[model samples]
Target: MYDIYSNAREDSWRFTLGKCGKRKLLTIGLNPSTATKEKSDPTVARVQKVALNNGFDGFVMLNLYPVRATDYRTLPSKVDEEAFSENIQKIEDLIRSEKDPVIWAAWGESITYHSFFRRALTEIISRLTLLDVSWVRFGEMTASGHPRHPSRLAYSWSFSPLDMEGYAHSLRP
Candidate 1:
């Protein structure tokens, strides 16, 4: 197991590298919740299971909320600038060491909305010059227009891989 940040809660994320060793995929999540720890993040687990089921294992997991635990509604203000920077550096280094066309998956909306995850991605994009990446927004459709349930909002969204190819291709100058 890699030495992940100490502050990160257990089961916040999990990584499974592809067995072929040719391609790499990264999955990032909004934060750790009671449900995530208990079930190993069903949404992510489903994806990882699918990858393994299909014979691919190059998957890496990251928790957007590395330092403090907070729900989606409380995320905007709970941002830790320093931790965010450190995590970004770590991710950038990881990407730099890997080959081209890295596949990245953001587990949910909060992961993308939170400054920690967003800034880290921004930094990775600017520093490492990543070629291929994907952002998957999962489980969000469940609560599209419904009144935000305080307890269920975090777990509502199902995993859906959003396109990062076109965005990465557009990045080339």
Candidate 2:
């Protein structure tokens, strides 16, 4: 069965890996990188490890934006409206698939790469607030208070509760 979901094939504009059971730890990254169903990238590998270590058997990976860029610096200077809207719908579906979903805020400082990052996150937060989801982060937040991205984290690190509302406000301009 294909647990990985995407709106397109070549330039996948929206991607979500929702394997495991209903009890999943959903992670929100700044955007999707190069990971696919056939292979795993460092971020995806790290997320899977963290989830297993933290009591989750499988994980759900989502992102503020879905454009697959090898680096955040390469994401289009602006987001396409269709991609943004579709990604939100995918996010909502993931949320509804679980009970009291526990989400990990792992987008890190890249949230500042563009104004759209915050806007996309704001939309995510709005949708999450409609349900009973738990927001979490790994280790201490950065100096500017963004969540810790898996790439920079120690494998031994664990999760901590993140104040979703306050965290969102801190990112606003």
Candidate 3:
């Protein structure tokens, strides 16, 4: 798989930890948390568990922006457009390699915080659509049409890829 997070300051980027190949689950989230060796981020753990249970042998992750920040407000106001654009291309390539992929649109409300971030996210999904990839949700969407945050998903919930026209409409750039 293309290592989108392999850059020098890659510790800031979050990525998949398990098996990766065909029939993959590519999770889309906000910025990554401050996970360390002593503790794993609960959200990433939950997504990994769900992907494994759903027969997805491979997993990947793509975020709206490439930077890492535990809190959204701490993110840089100006994105590194070159790095961000490269990561987006890597995401597109990863999805193309999967025979039947499930992209988890789990960005939650962070999409509402910045117009630039939201526009980049919408463009990523638009590109994915051209590739005919489907999006899956673990639980209910918020009023703004985002899937429940990974931390909010219940262990018993099932995955489903419902019509996202409502979400698409809400993300107009």
Candidate 4:
């Protein structure tokens, strides 16, 4: 099944943001970097910092394939469909338990493109029509001044609180 860890020492996945009761946003990622790897993913840290600064109090960061050892680049091959299914169920459980509306924010294109999320969301949409859930893209910028994807802006002008607070403000409703 999907292996989830809470502490930063046990896993690279860390929730650096301050928890203010139930979170209004839930962030999802493909998986955490190998713990033994010297360099951690800068994008993950950036996401955590930005989300916290923007006042997104609650986040559920998930790894579609939760295994201790696996190549991140070749993720499609390593994914266990059964385990992935179970992980989504776990996420749904969290969403159901939340008291406020929670947005489903995808960390990168990898998560947006993953079939597990896209397909599962279609089903979730039908069942939870009144949940007020939506998807927001994160970490599209890079440290080198180059954009993560050429078509998208260096940062999400639409979602970045640093770049623009309009999107965050609009979420209040």
Candidate number achieving the greatest TM-score relative to the actual structure? 2
- Order by lDDT, highest first: 2, 3, 1, 4
Q: Spell out the clash pairs found in candidate 3.
A: none
Each prediction's Cα lDDT score? 0.45, 0.83, 0.69, 0.44
What are the per-residue Cα lDDT tens digits for candidate 3 across 1-173? 23223332646654333345556688888766754333456766777788888888656656777676778888777777775776677677767877766788887877778676777776776787766778778877877667777877787888888566567776775
lDDT of 2 at 130: 71
TM-score of each model, in listed order:
0.54, 0.94, 0.83, 0.53
Give the Å shift of residue 70 in candidate 4: 7.2
Where does the lowest 10-residue lDDT sum fall in candidate 4?
144-153
Candidate 4 Cα outliers beyond 4 Å, as residue runs:
1-24, 35-41, 64-71, 76-79, 111-117, 120-127, 138-173
**Model 1 lDDT tens row, 1-173:** 22222334243332222223455455455554433322444444554554454344555555444443445655556666666666666666655666653343443334335445555555556764434544444334333321111233344344455445354343333
TM-score of model 3 vs. true structure: 0.83
lDDT tens digits, residues 102-171, model 4? 4434433443445554454444444455564554554444442212321233334435322213322332
Angstrom error of the Cα, residue 160, model 3: value is: 1.6
How much does candidate 1 score in TM-score?
A: 0.54
Worst 10 residues of 1 by lDDT: 142-151
Q: Which RMSD does model 4 reach against the true structure? A: 8.9
Q: Which model, 1 or 2, shows the larger TM-score? A: 2
